[model samples]
Target: MNVCIEDCTPRSASVFSRSNLRLESTLQELSLYDFQVDLDQVGMVLAKMFETNPTIPGVILNHDSQFIGMISRRRFLEHLSRPYGRELFLPRSIRALYKLSQVELLILPGDTLIVDAARLAIMRSPEQIYEPIIVQISETDYRLLDTQQLLIFQSFIHQLATELLQEQTQSQLMQTEKLASLGQMVAGVAHEIRNPVGCIVGNTHCLTQYYEDIMQLINAYEQELITPRPSIEELKEDIDWEFLKNDGLQMLKSIQVSSEQLKHLVNSLRTFSHMENKQRRETDIHECLDSTLIILKNRLKVGIDVIKSYGNLPKFLGYSGLLSQVFMNLLANAIDALEETANHSHNTAKIWISTHVADSCPSQLRSLIIPPKNNPEYPQNTESSEDPLTPNSQYIVIRITDNGPGIPKEIQNRIFDNFFTTKSAEKGTGLGLAISHQIIYEKHGGCLHLLSTPGIGTEFEIVLPLI
Candidate 1:
């Protein structure tokens, strides 16, 4: 009889039943019996089988149509070469050679996942690693498989997964670069616009003074005119002098107020986009918080009560602008959460900000320094600094709290993950909290954490090491 083994097409119904057998496979759909071979007899018959396939590593040995243990080729040959080995074991029952089996045959279910089987294969010794794994299709039926083949399939899948991740990372990097360029442009425009606006404000003030002097002289001239002149009366009626003078003063005052407001907005924009290198120096946190509040004053005017309980704070060595951004994002989010909650419920929205300098960090801060291994919500530090032997470090603690609907427990762990947000796309770009976390943790070696109770409130704590 002639025999051939080639890849099977998708339409093939039974590749192994005929002499001309073929197979097709993908990583997830690998054939279980890739290394399988059958045995009809043993002794001289098994020896002839070994001579015919000397290079084949091992086999899923069967005896009289019954599944048996795995045998290593080298060990079997060594046992056979022993003195009187052929007379003692050959042609006798092959069951007597069961003691020569080197590897414990692992019988897994036919439907067992290839990944899971690969893990089992790794547990075996080096000598038995190449042995065929036996997959049991039924109580009386079994199929042999190659462990190395499964591992190769797993490697191919991982390669594809890594490529997909690289593509996503590149896209995010491009978006970040665009935002950085835009911020620089905005900062430059705000700085340039401030100069011309300041000149306009000064000229407007001078014009207002000149108008006042002319008005006083005209009033004096009218009072000095003792004879009532019809021509003077006609001139006053034609000019509507009373209304013109009053409206003119009002317009000047409006211009003054508007120019001052414009200057304030420009200053806020400049502060928010300050892109100076992150510098560690003695800087007041309170001033930064106040500047952020000015930027957000318009939003807070809508029924959000802000209460500040500031303790005597010592200036610390840290990045002032980045910390200001952190305060801004947190306060802005609090405002949004409060507004959403207020729309549904009739409760008053409240935000409380408190800060103080401390000799030692708070318990919340300590947890971040040395996170508990069991709590999956808290991130584990790559390195810890809570050691008692290290020099004592002072700390700055800032707490921001809001009375609004709190975040749910299930997803609070994901708040610091990049590109994760609960707000609409137009309202939030999903980078606020993630960027804040990076600024506090990676840039300044600080800690940021939060506590939330549903239907009650949420509080975020920022702790920074002070020098």
Candidate 2:
């Protein structure tokens, strides 16, 4: 007898990309078994079709061009192997055998997720667990999927998730090491500078006293000019003593002012160098922010103004060094955004920084701050919004807002993802905001959120509980 396998399109021909498949991949991406046969055909004909396509997992059954059900190869062969089964059923219609021994069929939509499909497939009775799945592609189209193939793809997705997690952890560790190294270097440099600045300040004071004594002697000489000799007058006029005497004091005063400025800068640098500290201290938030600004002084352009409204906050018990790092990242990003559109913005960039206790904030902004559950050991908040680690304790809110070209709405959702960046590789590692988010959310048991409107501006709001 001549028989042909109809509609035997292997799903493998329609490739599902391994690299592109993620945790949310659907069953539509998998290769399906689309071999179907008429239910009215005799069992011998169905057996011949299976023989023609030995690799097919199962056959979709239809009557009058309408989907009725399906029968897997394993089930069909088992039925045929029964005593006198071929003698009784082979010559009979496939519908006769199908009716006599039919098992429950598991059907899923084409859009069903791969992982979810696997779960549903495994829930079947042990006897029907390996049976082929009926996937309805549309009202008029249906197909079969091998349970083994579904589990394989789910395993691939599981492996991908694990690798991504490891990558993120390694990146965060490297970032923490880099910040510690930077803090140590800055502290050493600040220490070296303080000694020289102190010497200049101390010597300037001694020099001021000596200059006064010398001026006194010169005035005394002028007063005791009893002779008023012509040669003496000529010497004083040639030396221009009056101009020298006045300019000398002015020069000494200028030196003192410059030395004082140097000392202030050194102090700021030392404050920021706390990044290497492993212990949490009684940190002053305003001081930490001011030190960060001082470190970024060179980047803060003349046109870029930093307006700060610091609320009256008591000392916070936290890791100031890491918090300062987070502040630096957010501020630096704001500066870079402003600089990117400097020409278009016409040097009108401004950053507004505000800090306030969560309870003291206005009703609108207060809801955004969620207090941590525990006082001393608050756990990190995951990506889930419904189960935030909220407590009744007080919290602090820090907002860093910038008036610049805002982030595009499409890419904003992925801004905090690790190694994701729009800037060139040399300009950005894409880790600045990611590491900052980690420091605020995971390390400090807080939350970091970005609010932006295209062409308007962007703001990074950090909410930390006062633990």
Candidate 3:
């Protein structure tokens, strides 16, 4: 039976277009042969139909208008080639021929995933592997799906998967370059600003000492006076010298404190922006979190309440820069969510950042959020480690939670998808969470999980191996 490759119109029709082809596409979506013939029909009738339509893989057979089974052109032709086969089957009801030619039938539901159907189709016996599949559309309706068409769909899907992965890899590389450039720019700015801040801090310290020395001299002058100096007393009273001495010292101390804080902020920015490093090292997770928070303090100061719960964790051997990127993205998202919700309600906008070490995967973090490769039910990347919480395996768990109008359940699953976001254009590029996911999932062989309740809150959990 020649299944005409050209008649598989779905491919040319853009049914499998790069933008539309999905692993979840079903058998019914492809071209299905709906021609049916009665089991009692003469062989000549079915033979005539096959001759007229070579594209039809097979015909569904029914007994008295009731579907019974199916017979492919290949099998029909072979049965007719037997000794005196035409004279024997062509004259009699096709039921005799059907009974004799019956082979294993692969029946699948119409809604079966194409990938799954292909798997089942290939699992057929070698003899029946070329047979058309019986697609059960309903109780009494059936259609024929060519084995060749299915294999082609599977091949196309495989190609599309490879292309998608390549595109994602390229995008990630480009994003990495952007982050490195941004980091370099920030480092330069931080260096430039630290110089002046350093001067101010030093000058303020010296000025404080000078002021103390002048105050001590004034006191000595007062102690050394043999008689009341009326002119100096009148000058001190007119100028309010006592207030100046006390307030000037306090002002100098305040300048020193402000300058110190400026230095701390500069350091935080420097640490958070070190995205140019090419290697991983022992990184302090708490420091990374603190640096990210400080970088976002401007946004957080609006109305956000930050709650921190840091647990004992060991230094992790990982890309600190990339991890900080993830932290920044998550924290920024939390702050954004809280801010977006601030005007709509009276609730205190809050972001909760907590970290801890666990010997086992948390019950909630047994969760996986990675999109599927070919099967929509399972994620291939989530299994990077055989047992995420094997007996001796320890992991660092960091949770960034926010009290805001949480993400809708419908879009929660797709939040990590490339270029998927709920923010406006000016506020979002849709790449933040996706890049964060790649950093954690690919760079460190870790897991990123999302837990959200609509109208309640949202939490993003990052689980990294302690090693």
Candidate 4:
């Protein structure tokens, strides 16, 4: 049925006062109907309803006047063309039509914000389906609004949109806090893992040298035993020596390699976990880039090349460790993406990392004016300059670019969402970008965002304020 905004009545003074008052009210009147049809008759009923009234968007089905399920106009036509629909006629019961009515029944409290309901509807509805029906319930009796429901539904939808945006913003903040905590944990673990790994490497190297010397002695003994006049005593000693040398050497090498790998892992963990101390100090962006490259070098695939376009830049006051980690993750992901694309071809993969100072940087006078109690990292100082050329106005911009399959438009919106990933479980935790976003935004007072084309590639630009 066609719903119009003008016919619906506002329930309260607050209803008309809201910025998106119309959308808020629209959500209130959009209720589901408990209209049930047999499993066999669903297709016919749906087709007949829509054919009779092409404007009908959707309807809810009920069994024995009890809420059961609902169907949309678009889905009804699609169902009729399916194999299941061809086989069924006036089906004896609607029980078999469960597959046809794929719509999910959502129950919302009357007091719930209309914005939230609309978000749920948008998120859950299939690509080509009608907007979800909002079922308003009050004990046993319920009435479905027709054309009159449109205005109220529209108002509710607008309110819901505003609320959804706010929720998304809050979600981003929460994710940032979580990632900061995680980085702290990783840093601690990396610090702990590093010491033990160093010890293991040192010990293994010493043991390997000792084993090599023993092997040389065993070789000499074997040579004597194999001589024309072989001594039985020499043979016995040589036999045990050979076994000891071979096993000991192998074990030492294994330990050495394992220790090295553990060290690498620790380094990665340390980079990822460490938080930037807010105290703004002059820091070299090039050094951070170099450290990140060193850690990720081994992870890069053969034939993949990294190009650095670092400009002669002044050191800006900022957290170095956190920024290094951000670069590491972004660069690493770029390398991985290129490697993934290179898997099927012989093409060489390349990643570009660049850094420079922003020309028209804004002064941090406003930021500096705030008392130290407001920000532990950089306390307010009246001496700080308010001009663009002053140190306070200087800022750094870093860009990481990759030539891989670009992000799809559909999935790009949620790329920074927690647990959202295009990679398989083993390849990614999906937290890297999300964490990166937090680090750049919250920790460094920077911005991180993507620029891409479907087949061209993706570029992430990061902008940070220089103290």
Candidate 5:
């Protein structure tokens, strides 16, 4: 046997009242099935009703008590003013004036919430959004809801949602700015420390050579079987000359190695953070990729393989530092994808970087690049370029691909959207692809595109014009 359990706890009187109030609120409470005319009525019937009841904006219709359609006062006026329309239609029946092009009457049950009625009304066509929604009260009774009141209700909700989204965006930007400031501080400190570390490395090298020369002289003197003076012997024993000779050299070598490593790290940090220059210059983009790869070497050494297919191309004019940051972001993300792939299989994870030149049209390229959402802070460039990318123009396209779980098609259009991420909160800030998109399209006047298949892989293509 099944036993049923029910909640017997008492609820507050105010809560019960609120629930009762919500149940009683519906479209049926608005009005009744009046202000209607018959389809057989003369066309002048609508004009006469409008004159008699000037407050009513529209009238519904019925044929043998079957709902047919509705006509608004505004439309009736326009029809009457048309040349020869009054003479042609005013004396005719309502069926003669009715046209098939009119918007279909939207119907809803009387039990529908006002909010739901408003939502259904706005979902209609551009012309129909302002038309009254028919609320059915009974089998043969109905009511017309004013679209103006419904729209006003929706406008308030829309305004509230917009304000909330604005607040969220503002918070995201504040976090990004804090991170940016921290990165700048770190870069400044690294730059200041590099010079002193270089000096220490150079001095250690000299000391290592000097110590080696002293050891050589001592060995030569000892090989001749010349007895050291008592004072010298005591000094050697106190200093543990034999241990010092081996360990002292090892210490200097360790220091030198560590110093070199530190310098490389400092250089990598500088490369990743050095996007301050906004000027375009003639520089090798391959070198930028190489530097980025060097910085990511530690992460790539475990199970990842990077394959580069470089092509001979001219030095394109662009911001080297900004381009380097783009490469760094792409390569880093590729490595992350490969690492994720490695966790599931023993297969060798790989990333492919290739470059080539091709012909492209600016108009066609513009369609591929997603325009930025309306952001008042960063206004978009509305003017067309004088030197547009004609079909004859040569474009250098750089492709970065990774053999990993690809991005889903649903989110392909949003990969470059600001503050959008597939990664966890601790792993990403969601600005890498957004910044890269801006650097390529807004700054370099290039295009960024992505192609992906879920089971296959993901590829990003960056196209920059040669001219």
Candidate 6:
């Protein structure tokens, strides 16, 4: 039977022989009667067809041989007992049946590349029925491949499937990385918003208290002056108009102070949130650091000293707002760590910040360095460079070190990961280092990493390229 089937295989000669055979070879064959049959009848026809010609696994079901839908013997049997099988088998039309089958099918030309044809076959998944057959169609002819061509076609289809699966896996990994970065950004924004909100709430509370006290004083004056009594001199003595004026003036001053505090809180929020625009200019690293220090000076704890070790650094193109954020996180972290240590003993806490010119070498920075790419996150360089540094050369190295208990070894590796925090949930959002990492890596094509010892202290270093 195998030999006979091999001898009867559709070869080039038989494929191109008579006009009818050529037409069959070129066009996908269909039978209207088979498509009109009930599920049982269709199954019988499929079984008989497969029994007679084992290689022919699928058939085109049409009303008049004009392509309507495809039926696969293997798929029909596999889904025969499934929950949706009864509904699928009762499809009223060939198109309905094809939709129920969930199989893909497409006809191909005789000269189509094996690779391309295989991709379409896998995408269509016409093979489980009987190694999906591609019918070659021409204006007046059609052809089906012989056994040799069928084997080659099947091999190519499998290869395409493997390649597609690999590509999907890699795409998923990239998406995961992007999502992780986004999570960090969300947390950082939340943390940065908390301080301004707290300030607003506290000032409003103080204003409410002052208003209550003024209302009480006014009520007392009204009771003394407008009470049901006929003592005009007593009322005049109780009024104390001069004292009321002075007290009223003081209350107004208090309200003004509260209002100003609320305004300052709002301004800080606007400044931090609108940093994207402020950082777009070619900014000096020295100036950015100094400005951040000035703004955060009041927040520093008593006896906490700051030391600057700025070197001859060139102006680099950066977003001042983002750079300020980086400085703020680092400075805040340093202060927090120092304060925690100072609680143990009265050793004066110190934070050291330094910026210096550096050579463009990956070895100089421990983290993976990505040079700035053109995107919404980082500004593209449009201005012609007149400086000695190449567009990708001359990086600024900013190191922030503090004298405090260094990070634990186990958590150091995950310091920059999203939502990884060592501090209490209320104290830290675990996004500070993560955002700093993204700003340095994604936005600036820079690097942020830690150098620390558990007992001594921790240092965070950032490197940004100057163009």
Q: lDDT scores for all predictions? A: 0.70, 0.81, 0.81, 0.62, 0.73, 0.59
lDDT of 1: 0.70
Cα deviation at 147, candidate 1, in Å, is: 4.1
Model 1, residue 21: displacement in angstroms?
A: 29
Residue ranges of candidate 5 with Cα displaced over 4 Å? 1-103, 106-130, 134-146, 211-219, 226-254, 275-278, 311-316, 355-396
**Model 2 TM:** 0.74
- On lDDT, the stronger of 3 and 4 is 3
**What is the lDDT for 441 in model 4?**
62
Per-residue lDDT of 162-257 in model 2, one digit per residue for the tens?
A: 898788679768876886788799889999999999999889988988998999998898789877889878887999978988999999988988
Residue pairs with clashing backbones, model 2: 11-31, 11-32
Better of 1 and 3 by TM-score: 3
lDDT tens digits by residue: candidate 5, 1-467: 11111211222223333223332356665443257788788888778777866655577777877877777666777788889887866688877777722567888999887667787888888977777778788887656666875555445445655775787689768976885786688679779988988888798888888988988997898888677789988988999988888998899889888888777777767766665555777867787777778778889898788999999878988877678878878888888787777878666788999987776655655555554565543334423453334467888888899988888889987888777889998878788888888888777877677888996788888888877
Best by TM-score: 3
lDDT (tens digit, per residue) of candidate 1 on 1-467: 01111221211223322222212222224554322233434456556555765544445566555666655556667678999887876676455665665556777877666567777888888877777677777776555555665666555455555675576467568767876776688689989999988987887888788888888998898789887599978888999978999999889878878888778777767766767574676667887887788889999999999999998988767777678789999999999999897778787789999998778754545554422233344456533453321236677789999999999988777787666789998888677887787778766767777888888998998877775
lDDT of 4 by residue, 26-113 (tens): 3444343333343345445555655655544555555555555556655666665777664572243444555655655555654555
When summed lDDT is taken over every stretch of 10 residues in candidate 6, the lowest stretch is 29-38
Q: How far is candidate 4 from the true structure (C-alpha RMSD, Å)?
A: 17.7
1 or 4, greater by TM-score: 1
Total clashes for model 4:
25
- The residue-by-residue lDDT of candidate 3 on 77-134, one tens digit each, is 9989999999998888888989998998999999999889999999988999999999
For every candidate in turn, the CA RMSD to the true structure comes to 8.0, 5.5, 5.7, 17.7, 10.1, 20.0
What's the true lDDT of residue 232 in model 2?
79
Model 6 segments more than 4 A misplaced: 1-273, 277-279, 362-364, 367-392
Which stretches of candidate 3 lie above 4 Å from their native place? 1-25, 63-65, 109-112, 136-141, 208-255, 275-283, 311-319, 356-397, 405-456, 460-467
The candidate with the higher TM-score, 2 or 5, is 2
lDDT score of residue 188 within candidate 2? 93
Collision count for each candidate, in order: 0, 2, 0, 25, 0, 10
